[model samples]
Target chain A: MRSLPPLSIFVFALSLLIACSHEQDATAGSPGAVDVTAAWARPSLPPHENSAAFFVVHNRTDHAVQLLGASTSRAGVTELHHMEMDGDRMRMRRVPSFTIPAHGELVLEPGSNHLMFFELPAPWVDGEKVDLHLEFDSLPAVDVLAEVRPL
Target chain B: MKWACLGLLLVSLGCSDSDAGLLDFQGIGGDFTLTDEQGQKFSLAEHRGQVYLLFFGFTHCPDVCPTTLVELQEVFQRLGGAGQDLQILFVSVDPERDTPELLASYLQPFDLPVIGLTGTVSQVEKVAQAYGAFFEKVALDSAAVYTMDHSTRSYLIDGEGKVRYIFRYKDEPERIAQIVRKLLP
Candidate 1:
């Protein structure tokens, strides 16, 4: 087998190190026993209306975790909601709570389920991070940062 | 055995007739008259030679509506020069709050030539019925704070003013562009 050149080997090792660090950064900031990742919100044109945020909640512990609710200072009120198709119409319904099963993950995504922020006081600035407080039944609140981007 | 052969022959005939490349969407939509964002009288017949993508939504929809529009914007970009022949029409289901001026401003940020249309409740209902779209006003505890529940599907109309395909909100935007390019003469 032919050995890779010294310059090529150095570059390959550097890239591997960068990839590992990025993976660590993604899973680094977990509050308590829950791991939240890929949190993002769709940017709203006129801030006064409602908007949505999406993320994934992973339960690293053996016990089941229930997402009771969520809150944000930017909106007057925030609610847990999901979209359902009734006939041809798509309607948004408020969900009381979402459960993160033990050793499993709950994904909040677009066109399915999301965190609806109603009556936003101001428009979400592009590229800004909106701080979201996710409340659990027994665990302490987890602060997830959702980056606002144009949909 | 005779009846089975007859049934097979009938199925073949049905498949061949719908292979005309228009997808057998004959009765889904028809011509309608409405007012555009500029308060001008608009008719479906006027846009007969241009392909148009139609969606039913409201200005206040924070999640699905805007998300779909933004995706459409990417579709426009992917179409490149061919996009000039494509028209995006946003029909407001909540006519009470989606006025001409409001619709104009609400669609400005998408950076696409999105025409907003709203009419009287009955007028809008007629158009929605033509496309088999659903929209209903859901009143909350407070009368002033309410939202509309509407369908998130978009219709792809060919240049000859024929509804050829239906794109659900989850459909990939590139797939929509591909269908439109094939339909564009």
Candidate 2:
């Protein structure tokens, strides 16, 4: 068997270290492990006191992830809400948590599950961007920037 | 016999070139007096020659109410100049919270010709009952103490103030505009 050169051995060892670190990152539950996409919120009119934000949470991990809640400086209170149709009537209720299955996604959209913002400090205007801090059951909190769009 | 066959075919297909194809909701709607956003008494009988779209909702409803109004704005945009003949009557089911001023402010964002209507609890109840609309206040544990759950249908009244058709929740805006156009002069 032939032995490799000193330079070749050093480069091979560095590549191995980088590969191991990348694998470690995949299991560390970093913000990059989970993805939040299509984040947008509705523009709020005066005296309405409330608005809603929608997005899709994609979990790439091997285990199911639970989304506990979210917070934003734009509103005094933020809660998870689901809108359901009972016959011809529409009902909105608070939800405790949403679980995203392994490699699955949870979609929050209009007329469905969403993040309800109550007691808005100021009305959300079209083209305004709002920062949201999302908390999870196990992973580190993720920060998202949602755009305000007219309904 | 050929003419008789053509008549049967038309009847089976429900083919019509006029308002004969429109749904008849004759018994569902009637005249009701409510306070408009300007704090003036608004009687349905007063707007006899104009088309009206009536919707039951509240100002604090975060999702459906605004979504419906925005859809109405799109409908108006589709209608263009003809939309001026159409008036939207937004009846507030949450009489305790949705004052005339609040309804006015909430509806200001939508550029459509909208009349925000609110009245006393009993008055609102009477109007809702006349149209078979259902609405109730639901309590919550959050800072926003309660929310209103209401029917999500839009009643389309023709120029003569007769309920001609009912638009379900999230109906296509283009279709609504098309139906409303048929009602215009």
Candidate 3:
């Protein structure tokens, strides 16, 4: 029997490590599900301190995942908003739920859909972080850190 | 003698009249170089002869970016022959993810002269800052997970490669078309 070469052994070990790590990532049940990143609260004016948080979410798996609901201690309610333009008028509407398909991406971008946190119990200062409880279907519940920024 | 004097005065006045608009940077467009869809180097000065409508966005911005481009295409089509003298440029704010290949494929849906421009972070910063573009990278603490907050302004460039105006994201293409008519000679 011949002993394996060091180079070949190293390559084989590396590939196995990569595959194992990838598999471990799937244990979260999201397959390749990911929620929005670096989402934060935007400061607002008086009367209506309503502000939106923006982020990016991706689904790495081959199956579709739905974003069912989101909750935050900072506000009384959280909503998924989609900015729409009908004819020449621009408006924002609430969506029942946002969906992310396998190998697909969803962005909570400005001038588009966003996570709206309405009427914060208190105003947020610059550099403050808030905790958000985000719930996803078929994936683990995730806690998000929402940073505060000037309007 | 009177006719000769009048002719000379008119000639001098005509020579002195310059395009004051170009001399002033109205919309404040900065200069940069990035690869075009055809894999050729594209610089602002190279497109000097045409009016340009530039947007800083990523193809991944599913709704806003595509919707704006569609409206812009209609505006260009409305221009008819005037569109010939016009160029619509899409400069991706997410260069790390938006490659030349993706940009090319992404822009195929729009029927206009859509050029995608992207470069390194510093290079993109110079152009974005000059045009008042704002983008912030959101770090999620997860490996390889981040989001970008980019400026949502659509820049308008005149024939001289200078920024002429800026429109809000929701600005109607018809309003833009109205402006295009008076912009060209």
Candidate 4:
């Protein structure tokens, strides 16, 4: 597919806005049995469109844990999606389950495991926070913040 | 002799430590095979000695894809003629609509040597999975136009074909350019 390139100056401004908002944690993230944080909304999307919330999930337990499901009020439904391909096709599947083994971590960034909002309840007025109710096997379900970016 | 052996063991372990979260376990960069807009086959192995910026999205992407690529072009231009060996690849996550001919024409306007790639639905899926990129086709029953929602990211591959960095779609151009400059020949 193709798109007309945007002007260089607007690109610069957009880059600057994002640079201030994004933070990378190579060492440690949310301190909980099942950790999650760094959530952000897709800035360019409209209300009717699907949006993804990116974050990092870490499991510090001795036994493996699974991310069974997710719930969010901001959107009608949320699911744990893993990126998969049959051959030349790239599609995100709502996995039956995903395991974060003992002492292991899952980074739900742009490309990996992330929360998918199938149908947003309303147009994301940039900067609003959407809450995701995270579900895990043994860990108590917790709510995480997803910051909406101005489109 | 015991002291010397302890030093050697510690050094070996230290050298072995690297970020495990980002790369796959095989120790090889994820495997991918797709056709370029010019009807030419392209693979990561073919560009082992040069740095490349990669973006995975459909040709019809309305926002993130174009925004990310333009920033990359700015970085490439900032690098001047030194970016000649550096490749910028756009892999179409939506194969149903993106053909080689469409991809070729899509990249014609860009100042850089940008190659647009597309393959069968399954073929492109494999490519996206290999890079850890995610995409989903949005179905619209009423509207003629639909969109493929995808990861808004660009991966930076070093000369050795290792994915060294995954730049956020909104990262600063100068920081991206700095990383490219260090990897450039």
Stretches > 4 Å off in candidate 4? A1-151, B1-29, B141-144
Any runs in candidate 2 off by more than 4 Å, and if so which?
A1-31, B1-18
lDDT of 2: 0.88
lDDT of 3 by residue, A1-151 (tens): 9999999999999999998888777666533357567687655323233456767777776778778778788777777767654433334556777888788877776666777766578865568887877677777777878787643
> How would you encode candidate 3's per-residue C-alpha lDDT over B1-185 as one tens digit per residue?
99999987755334322543222343466677877766678888876667888888775453466567778888987888877777778887777876777778777745778888877778777788777777766553322244455666676687767666567776788877876665676
lDDT of each: 0.82, 0.88, 0.69, 0.68
TM-scores of the candidates, chain A only: 0.75, 0.80, 0.72, 0.69
What's the count of clashing pairs in each model shown? 0, 0, 3, 15
lDDT tens string, model 2, A1-151?
9999999999999999998888766656654668999999998777758889999999988889989999999999999998988977999888899898999999999988999998887889889899999998868788999999986
Least well predicted 10-residue stretch by lDDT in candidate 2 chain B: B12-21
Interface RMSD of 2: 1.0
A28-125 per-residue lDDT for model 4 (tens digits): 22347677767676542422445667777778777788788787887776666665434433444456667888889777765456666666667665
Task: Write model 4 residue lDDT over B65-180, tens digit each, in one string.
Answer: 54566677788878888888788889898788778887766566456778888878898887777777778876643121455767766777777777766676667888788766
lDDT of 2 by residue, B1-185 (tens): 99999998766544554675466653578999999998999999988888899999988887888889989999999999988889999999999988988888888878888999999999999999988899988998766688889999999888677887789896899999988888876
The local lDDT score (0 to 100) that residue A10 gets in candidate 4 is 84
| Ranking of all predicted structures according to lDDT, beginning with the best and ending with the worst | 2, 1, 3, 4
